[model samples]
Target: MTTRRRAAPDATRRSEESRRAILAAAFDLVGQVGYARLSIEGIAARAGVGKQTIYRWWPSKGAVLFDAFLMLSEGETGRPALPDTGDLEADLKAVLRSTVAELNDPRYDEPMRALNTEILHDPALAAAYAERLDGPLKEAKKERLRSAQRAGELRADLDLDVAVEMVWGPLLNRWLQRSGPLTPHYADSIVETALNGLRRPTRRRRDQH
Candidate 1:
């Protein structure tokens, strides 16, 4: 008698479907309940799958949430496409402005808040969250900066990586901390402050008082 391989093509398809289901379920639940309150059973019920199915794929609630949020925010274009209109500053501003709108949307708020609270309670989880969301965003923003550099639109002396992080860090800091409701105006300020740069590399880093 011949035995069939366990991981056949149909098995692969089913696995992918199940994984997608789990991700969708996790996102939905996180939107409904804080990540702290979210549970494997909850995700399983939402996904219409057995708890064992989730456990078979993900090790922890944090893992499921991280993956779910990543998939929700990311897409086929890679990091949501940074509006490359050959005008780097305008492109960055437009994307950031839209991102501010996204952050301010009620549906998006809780999952983001959940992610933020997790970061505060668990540094490891925070690192993982940053790796998933912030890191890719930072890289994509940097790539847009690099495009600007190639086009000679930005000062050659500017460090593209530092500029990207500066632009990203402040705006994200606001959203994740709930320091204030995110705004397009804030996004514009970030772009302006970063692009115009502080102290103009001269008057002293802090002498602009």
Candidate 2:
């Protein structure tokens, strides 16, 4: 009896298709029915797969939406990314500008708000979302700050984690609290405030003279 080799490429292609379908279904359903009402069964039915198929890859509806949240947050490029120009201020400004745009976009804003609300009561879900979605860009920003410190552009004594938060926190506060509109001016001002505090001290004019 001859043994037949299984086709690895076919299996891989099918897996990609199924994953894409599942993500698409979750994204559409969340927008259509809101996050609280979305379910694995509903996603499975919409994706034309068994509920078991979803369970094979993810543990729960929250898990599925964690992946879906990543997709929604990626915008038209289908990737959530930050720029790295040699100038730290310019790079940070570009990213914050992108963020302001994302927050205001109807496609991302509504579903992201829904997801944020859902994660509050579920710590595990919140951690998963943070690890997958929030952590990378944050680490990248911190790394950029550290690079500036190395270049004598910023204070070496500053705690980078706190610095990163200083940049993110105000923007997030304004975004979530709805205290004010998220505009380019606000983003630029926030960046200026954070960066100014981090900049290296200059020699006093009197001392120089």
Q: lDDT per model, in order? A: 0.79, 0.80
What digit string (tens of lDDT, one per residue) describes model 2 on residues 8-44?
9988789768887998898778778877788899999
Q: Weakest 10 consecutive residues, lDDT, candidate 1?
A: 1-10
**Residue 154 displacement (Å), model 2:** 1.4
lDDT of 2 at 200: 50
Worst 10 residues of 2 by lDDT: 72-81
Quote each prediction's TM-score. 0.81, 0.77
Whole-structure CA lDDT of model 2: 0.80
- Report clash pairs, candidate 1: none
Model 2 TM-score (2 dp): 0.77
Deviation in angstroms for 2 in model 1?
28
- Residues 1-209 of candidate 1 have per-residue lDDT tens digits of 11334798989798778888998888888887877789999999988999998887788887787787777776555554477899877888898898798888767778777766777888887787677687776777777777788899887788777777788789878877678767778898898888886665665646876
The local lDDT score (0 to 100) that residue 82 gets in candidate 2 is 56
